[model samples]
Target: MRYEPISNELFIQNRKNFMAQMKPNSVAAFNSNDIYPIGADSTIPFQQDRNIYYLSGVDQEDSILVLFPDAPKPEHREILFLKETNPHIAVWEGEKIDEEKALQIAGIKTVYWLKDFHKIFHELMSQSETIYINTNEHYRAAHDTETREDRFNKWLKENYPAHQVAKSNPILQRLRSVKHQLELDTMQTACNITEKAFRRILKETKPNIWEFELEAEIMHEFLKNRSRGFAYTPIIASGKNATVLHYIENKHQCKDGDLILFDVGAEYANYASDMSRTIPVNGKFTDRQKQIYNAVNRVKKEATKMLVPGTLWAEYHVEVGKLMTSELLDLKLLDKADVQNEDPKWPAYKKYFMHGTSHHIGLDTHDYGLLHEPIKANQVFTVEPGIYLPEEHIGVRLEDDVVIQENGEPFNLMRNIPIEIEEIEDLMNQ
Candidate 1:
């Protein structure tokens, strides 16, 4: 890992929290993500499964975590199964985590090689009444590919027909949604790296520079700061491209009067930071551009204040929609009649501001928080609100990561990142 090691206490606490929610005599298991193949002998880079990483802090492939709190042996309560490392294998792929290192990384005393998994798992399963299997149940998930966890779940169900099964997703959804201070610290680091990249781009962007050039500059900054790269595919849209929310071609040349909508962030130690900023290509917003920019900025500010503790996610979006509607009416994008006659399901502001104002942001860009439940303090979210005007060839969005507080407004994680029109213009021209 390019990033520094995280404290094992975070994983230890996470495991404890997960175990607390498990049914008595239940043994829960988590598996690492597979190294997916592409075409020939080549394979995609390995990404550790978030659940396993959360519980064990083990970032390697072919790893498993078993939590059996009621085990006869105390050491067997929390066990880590890692792939055995040989000197020859170490020479090719660098040193894999040995048992001692695994113990240090995960704070689990018991460790075994993958070869002993079957015999050990059978013995453990026989002692437990229920099995908790980790599954992907995030709201945005729609993958067709079967993951390593999915394969393990299938095999377990088929092999042990008599064992009672339970889903681990619900428990994890509630637990992982609340941010630990350690997690917030790592995410803050990722946000700081993203801020540096944005500042770098502010100085580098100029009229006639191709969009890809800006992408390269951002990547350079991220790699220099110990980040793997973007948390998600970056959208470096310029001019009319900004109106298209997901535009990522990044092939067009930026014009003097055009604006570049940058939806990019850096990832540190697998934690994510999401930010979106629209800046003038030539370091100066026109009269009309400034008006729209300030409007979106205002919406983002007001929307952020709504992210207090005990607020329901569904209700929060409704309030944000009302805020956006008021801004749109002021901008003349929507009039009183437009809003009054609009459908409740799809409001008048939908024409200019289409997407949701905010989403949970952490380990994943769109991180885990149950949308139907009330949000809690310490939960981090992205406050992004935008207005896209295709006819005017203008789109403005200002986003920042924030943490909800027990009282008052949320704390802005990207508060240091320049967002004010004067601040951005001055820095870009300087």
Candidate 2:
């Protein structure tokens, strides 16, 4: 792990909260993500499954966490199974986590090697009446590749068909939607690293600079700050490229008198920070660009204010649309006739701003939160508003990650990052 160690208490509390929601006599299992193979003898970098890492703080491959709160033996209540570290593995792949280290890292007293997993899990299944299986149920999930967890689920049903099954996704969706203090602190670190990268880019950006060059500068800053890299695929769109919402080719050279849109964030310790900012390549926005930029910034501010407790996600978006419509009217992009004739399902503002204004952000760029439920305190969200004009070859988006407060306004995690036109222009010209 390049990032500093996270406090084990976060994992402890997360496990406690999740177990509390489990049905009586239930055992839950979480599996580590597989190290996907690209070709012969080579594999993609391993990433621990977020669900297992959330409960155990164990970041490794071929690891498993099983929670059996109703187990007859006290040690079986919480168990961690890790890949056995032998002398050969030590020499070739470095030392894997041992028993004592797992205790310190995950607060689990009973640690077993992978070889004992089949016998032990069978014993656990014989004793437990129900099993909770972790599954990906995020609103945007579209998984085609089978995962280690999926394979384990299939094996579990085949071997132990008598055990009643339940989904862990619902419980996790509600629990993980609310952030713990330690999680918030780690996300703040991620945002701080992203700020450094953005500041560095502001200084390096100029006309004829390739978008990939700016991306390289971002990676340089992230690596120095102990972040693995961008939380999601970064979008470094310049000029008309910015109009594409998911532009990531990053091959175009920035042109003078054109604006560049950056939808990028750095990840520290697996916690994600999502940020978006658009600025002129020439270090100053033209009058037309300023009009669109200020309009988007205004919408972002208003939308963030609505992310308070008890605010429904669907209704909040409708209110944000009204705000954007007013801004579009002020910018002369839409007239009274356009507003009256627009479809209610797809408002007039959708022409310029086609995407949602906000989404939950945490371990995943589009993290988990039940959209139908009302917003809550400690829940983090990204407030991003944009106006894209492909004909004008201009695109402007301004985004910030904010935490909903128990009262008053939400706390902006990216407050230190430069978003104001004057601040960005001054830093770029300096």
* Candidates' C-alpha lDDT: 0.93, 0.94
- Residue pair clashes in candidate 2: none
lDDT digits (tens) for residues 227-317 of candidate 1: 9999999999999999999998999999999999999999999999999999999999999999999989888888888898888888989
Best by lDDT: 2
Per-model TM values vs. the true structure: 0.99, 0.99
Report the C-alpha displacement of residue 426, candidate 1, in angstroms: 0.4
Please provide, for model 2 over 1-430, each residue's C-alpha lDDT reduced to its tens digit, 9 standing for 90 to 100.
7888888899999999999999999999999999999999999878889999989999999999999998999999999999999999999998798888887888889999999999999899989999999999998999899999999999999988999999999999988889999999999999999999999999999999999999999999999999999898999999999999999899999999999999999988889999999989989999999999999988998899889999999999999999999999999999999999999999999999999999999888899899999999999999999999999999999999999999999999999999988999999999
Model 2: lowest-lDDT 10 consecutive positions: 95-104
Model 1 per-residue lDDT at 405: 94
In candidate 1, stretches whose alpha carbon ends up further than 4 angstroms from where it belongs are: none
